[model samples]
Target chain A: MTAANGNVRLAARSLAPAVLVMGKGGVGKTTVAAALATLEAETHGLAVLVEFGDGESGRRALGPTHKGVEHVVIHAAEAIQRGATPLFGSATMAKLALGNFAMRPLLKAAPAIRELAMLESVRQIVEARPGVRVVVDMPATGHAVAWLRTAKQGREFLGSGPMFELCDRVARELVAPGRASIIVVTLPERLVLEETLELCESIALDPGLEVARIVVNRVPLPLAQECLVDARALAQGGGALAQPAAALVSLLEARAAASAGAVAALEVFAHGPHAIWQVPLAPVDPSARDVARWLRAEGAA
Target chain B: MKDPRVIVCAGGGGVGKTTTSAALSVALAARGYRTLIVTIDPARRLAGAMGVPITDVVTPVPLPAARGRLWALMPDPRRSMGTFLDFLFADEPEAKARMLTNNLYLGLADAAAGVHELVAMNLVARAATEGDFDVVVIDTAPSRHAIDFVTYPARLAALLGGRTVAWLAGLAQRSGGATATAPRGLLSWGTGHVEHLLARVTGPNLVRDTANLFADLALVRERFVALTRRASELLLGERVAYALVAAPTAAARDDVLFLAARLEKLGRRPRAIVLNRADTQAAPWVRALREGHGVAPSITEVLDVLEQERRTRATAADALAVELRSKLSWAAVVRLPYVEASAPEDIVAALSTELDAHLTALLPDAR
Candidate 1:
């Protein structure tokens, strides 16, 4: 790659055992998570792609999983049941309580139940599958924050119960350095970048949960200044190409200006150990293999 | 054609729903209608786009050029439950005091996604009633389950209005915070067994707190019911309009379809589908350059790449529009060109102008 490409080489050790891919909606969190899972599974022994909520995006992006990679969709209700089965001391009793109609609304309305359950489910998977990298496709920005903080909230709420112990275990795992890290994905747009910076600040407030990397997706390729000058000159020469040339110049100029602003913002925000990577704009949606190939070509492994 | 007093912009994240909501509100205000834009997203995007500081309180937006006035209510998610409680318990100070101090309630306030959504809807209801706005635009959260918040009002009302809550409240009253002992009542046979199982799973402390919280809430159940009823009416009313925002990407298309299906299942159809950034503005220009004699060889490679990218984007967008049109024939599908502005305000202003032209089609009676 040319020096102009500016792709950072991420060491393999930098990849945490648990990588939570998060960002604003529509910023390709699923794509990044899937790609990361594919890369990890191929490089390492096995990797699990974990998806929250509906969980279809991760599977769709990953497509048919190759050997050594697994996909699992986690729903709150099922997670809660799994968590309760151990707590209640019997599977049948857990089912009875959860199945009770009177308990349904109460459980649904209870605060942090979904978040705690999801974390508990993840904790179980990590505990059960040793030496497996877990890549989570987290929810959008706002809810994802809540999900990350659920362990703390659960401990405070439950105080001294079996559930509180579960929360403690999950919280410890999350705060363990080099064990869990966050990969924030964002676009190069002005507003998206601002939101991403704010999200990073919020995440930093939680100690031990590191912002390992920031991947700026869909950054347009920089156009040569001389080419733009030539286009402007061509536009000034009034002809059929004038309007088209002017439009092209304006479009390219606007895009370049926007990209420059994003670059400047990232420069100001760049600090500490977390690296910021930029993925150039692609013509179509990238598959997991494509992303893995791109990262490998960049020497990110 | 009837004019909608409420417009709800719903879609997945990063589809420009907040920007579209702000622009639509600006356009509505420009057309001489007093408008209030309420954003449920905690991301502060609307505030950034409008260049105004928005909080839980309704703040007037200084749209000096518009014929009518504009206001915004962007509730802080952290403080939404508190604000909502203050509103719900405006008259019942004792109940509010009790519930605020309750550990369960405190936990709920911190981690309850449902509370934030309900609080946002409640704030919108309060704004519409108290502000005397001609139209209110709601910018929903960026999630497939964003539409699920529409059911929160009814679901909460039902939960609070149910006999179970009354029984729980009665149990708390009899037991006086001691949930370990069973209180004898008509519903004891069924509830006693369920309570035992619940306590086994969630612990006695949680059960006690739940009972205490319900008892405090029982004092203001009537007000909660009334507030939720009003919010539900405003959301599910005939004059409410649903606008689904989408981009050209396959992810955005799926989000739009999913949201549309969710809305349809709720018996509310989308009134308009906003295809944001669905067109390449320079496509025609690039086509002309390719078709005509491009005498400049220096920029030939750049032009070729631009033309190919434009064709790819155009083809994808065209296919998306066709599929959406066929799937949702009832909703008016409006395409918004990609605004070539970097600043958030500039983008909003440009899209507002575009939306102004298509407002009538989107909102049939928008004059």
Candidate 2:
């Protein structure tokens, strides 16, 4: 690690880096978060990755997360059951609890009980290990907003339940500077990039939450400037079998245009110069190692 | 399309799920099935595809090309929940108003994650019987949340379990007697007497009016349960067909496999898997411009790079398709090329063509 890396690395340890990796459903959030965790674990000692939903994506990503890294998956339904156990008095209460939640007849009640339960679970994990790096792999854009909204509502609605206390703690930690950073991942497709920028704008509404850089994933690996010029010169030389050269420049240019538009939007939405990172479009699926290395390289750049 | 009773297009977000939902509805309607396609959080682009505004009210889209009627709408959860309340408290007018106005009941039916699904399924159940629609196509929220719509009945049933209803009814009964217990014409009692009377009958804080809600909704709990069960039965039962729509990415492919496994665990399975945007031809213009014409080196270089990218993407896509087929042994995985259209309708029209085989397989004789 470079001296600059050492400085930031030390800062991260002091601050207890907690990042919420967010994106649309198809965007590679798990891939990016796991890769970042793997890097932190290699650089620092303690890092815990948390997934909010029930899916195995987080656990699967954790397998390659370097040693000493912890993986904690919070299945919302199960968490709610844990919370409902006292009320249900037994497993049979699971159904009634789920129904009441669905109907949301109670304040701070709704299927969002899962989000509430998940928030409480995250707070415990963060509080228990003060200096531990917490990486939360959040759900997609739409559902993610719902989770954030729940944090705000839980504070207002639940007068004095254990839920209100957890929500207050989480809401504070999530917005605290250097304590939590939200990283948004996006594919370079026109629509996906635009949607991501919109998400960044919406997340900005939360005065307490701090959004990090936008990670534009799966950008086709770009060639050096001189190499592209040479390719363009060769293509302009009219000849047989010159089609490949022309297509390369056009394809690369198209990708550059898409990225530029998204970046421009990101800058405008962020209200200042925003940090934007790009990941090379993978030839095949990338492993955790590939992503970690790529992140390091991007960081250096 | 087999029975054309119910069709749910489900997958993670950004996988073209919303587009797939619209196209399937268009195709099903064209094939002579009276269809209602309900999308949640429909983007403006998609709402524009139907050539009409898809709002809270169910509006029929005039599909000039389709043989049967086509209708579309985004479920209004508040309204649907109200309808549900009306059905539940149809017998007791005053009680219905109280429950509707109650903070807890209103809140539950309003934004509970399952509220949409509950409202949607309620809509679907209604459409299945009295609405006279041959097919009710559901386009759900992506990810595991999509499954929330399918399993919502259970959660809702538990919410209104027999005991919860009994408790509410019993409260209402006691409260009714308390109203009478106001010492035979309350003009004689002072204001303190009235306050005492209310305190005695209303049960303490939190549980106050708890009985009234039960009393009002007591009659419809069984019917509500019946409605929810029937909707879920339509979804998981033999009458429904499931299609998993996914973009051709390794991550999305992995999710498709997981979703299939999840469904299988529930004793259900996707009728077919729709692998959308499968064509690795990331840039279509390059292929069309370069084939036989001898282009300049600059153009050729660009073409070559584009071709290489395409080939690489195609290879990755083929591998994912192979993995999907191998793992989902029972499902027929259909691949759709990268749809080039930007306008919502054009994309839907293009996807409908790509999904022709699977749709045909579902209906067989419709076309």
Candidate 3:
């Protein structure tokens, strides 16, 4: 591993039990999820980062597709279908054709198919190896809420069916205190924060689920108080900096207010049950790996 | 395809799909087409943007300034289902009344995972074909994938296959309604794997009632099939156009790409991609203030950081735009500036004027 990888390993030593990163669209959930997964891999020996879609995003992260919905649904459907199949003397395997028919329709008709598939896939990943954890980069807020709600909903809707058993199992994995937790990632803007709060409020509503952490990403770095005080004093002298100072102060004020709004949201979030972390605005856009490295350094700091 | 009868904006949540629909409606209305924009955004930003309150029923938006007529509605799916049931059994009043008043039917309809999509499809199809509005714009739910969850072509037809409906209706007519006699165990309350599971879960009483409701639905299955067929045609027809609205981020563009791909498989692709809230690069005056006529040494340090950050953001935005173009097949990509307008009216008004010239030149007359 490179020095950057080594640094992440050190930081990963104390990650929370499980992490699920979610936010509104374009709120950097993928980068945050990737970062957390990298840090998780450090302590856990191996970590799986799962995306719920076509597995293209997963391919970008870990090369080959690490069992997501597309792969899991078929396996799950076959398993469930086999449950309905009788022991011996089955006719032409035609009874099982219904199973294949039911796969996409079941997954599509009920949110349960996708939900159970995703949850089971994560469980399989962690269980496949010793000391491994899984991080699910959940979809945006609206569907994320639906995805999270499906386990219990499936149990309620599909009682006694093979699908119900899986839902119950998934719910148990999610509910056990330290077994799983969700981390909400959001920007420092007002609208985004409002949406984040709405997400947190829903997370709080789920009975057994825990809000692990909230990362407020892409915040402007605060200027040094002394530097600002000196600048204020020097602006009175009116040199080459006067006009820029006037311009800078207003811009600085907006930046400061945005940061303040983020801090203020944290204060509100603190009333709820999650720990919060802030990621400073980067000079350049950072990828998932870069975010992981930065998070490690941030954790160290 | 400027004057297409329908424009549907699909994307992930909070990517300004509703705003894009509102703006497109405004522009089309300005171009002298009577327009209606339907939004399913629970946030209901459309009404706020139009300076009106959206209802389950369609309401004409107060467009004192815009030239053409405009209306908006948020379909309450259950109510739409009720109305649709009426239409389905229009010939058989007794059957329609019996189904409408049935508690089991109401429960099934209310709990329907498929009804919402069906209702949305019905509304858009009607807005295009039945309603007097010259143009209909749809702002759908922010589904997670490119193939959105809330709406898909012939979705109900696929999920509720004709054979499955026919079989259920046949059984229900024999056993559920007790109109015909049959030997037990075919679709008996206790037999058939699907019915067994349903009876086990919902209890025999509810299952029996639901089976009876299906018998009634069977009486109207032909109409339902015809309706879905109409919905499918309205969607894939030449008059409809799809557009993708995305923020200038990897995730949103990723959704646009996925949506474009999915639409392509259906032979229906997005006509335009709107990149919302794009950062405006520095102006000549601002550039001069930073480089040419610099003042205030105290502010110089912070100013330098701010300028550097702005440049970085601008570069990133441009790169993302280029990346989307390279990845996706759609070409009519437009960027809306990240202006500071909060209210819905201001956003709609600003977007209308801002998009007028560009949209006019880009969009073509419908064939």
List pairs with backbone clashes in candidate 3. Answer: A219-A281, A240-B295, A240-B296, A241-B295, A241-B296, A241-B297, A242-B295, A242-B296, A243-B295, B49-B344
Predicted complexes: DockQ each:
0.51, 0.18, 0.16
lDDT (Cα, 0-100) at B54 in candidate 2: 43
Estimated TM-score for each candidate: 0.88, 0.75, 0.73
Question: Residue A169 in candidate 2 has what lDDT?
Answer: 70
Residues B272-360 of candidate 3 have per-residue lDDT tens digits of 77777665665332464557443445445655665676667667667767877777656577777543333456667767766776564
Selected candidate, larger DockQ, 1 vs 2: 1
True contacts kept of 2: 0.19
lDDT tens string, model 1, A69-185? 788899988998888888778888888877766678877777477777887787777777877889888877876877778787667777787878888888887545676888888
Question: For each candidate, what is the lDDT?
Answer: 0.76, 0.64, 0.61
* Per-residue lDDT of model 2, residues A1-301, tens digit only: 5865664464344433577888887677888888777778777776888876564776666564368678888876677666555444455544443444212343222455667677767776787887778888887776776677666665665555444555567677664566677888887666566677667777777534546667788776554555467657756776753565665555456556655665666665442222566778765567666886777666656
lDDT of 1 at B285: 69
Which residue window of length 10 is worst by lDDT in model 2 chain B? B183-192
Instruction: Name the fnat for model 1.
Output: 0.60
Cα lDDT tens digits for candidate 1, B105-137: 776665565567777777777677778888888
Q: Pick the candidate with the highest lDDT.
A: 1
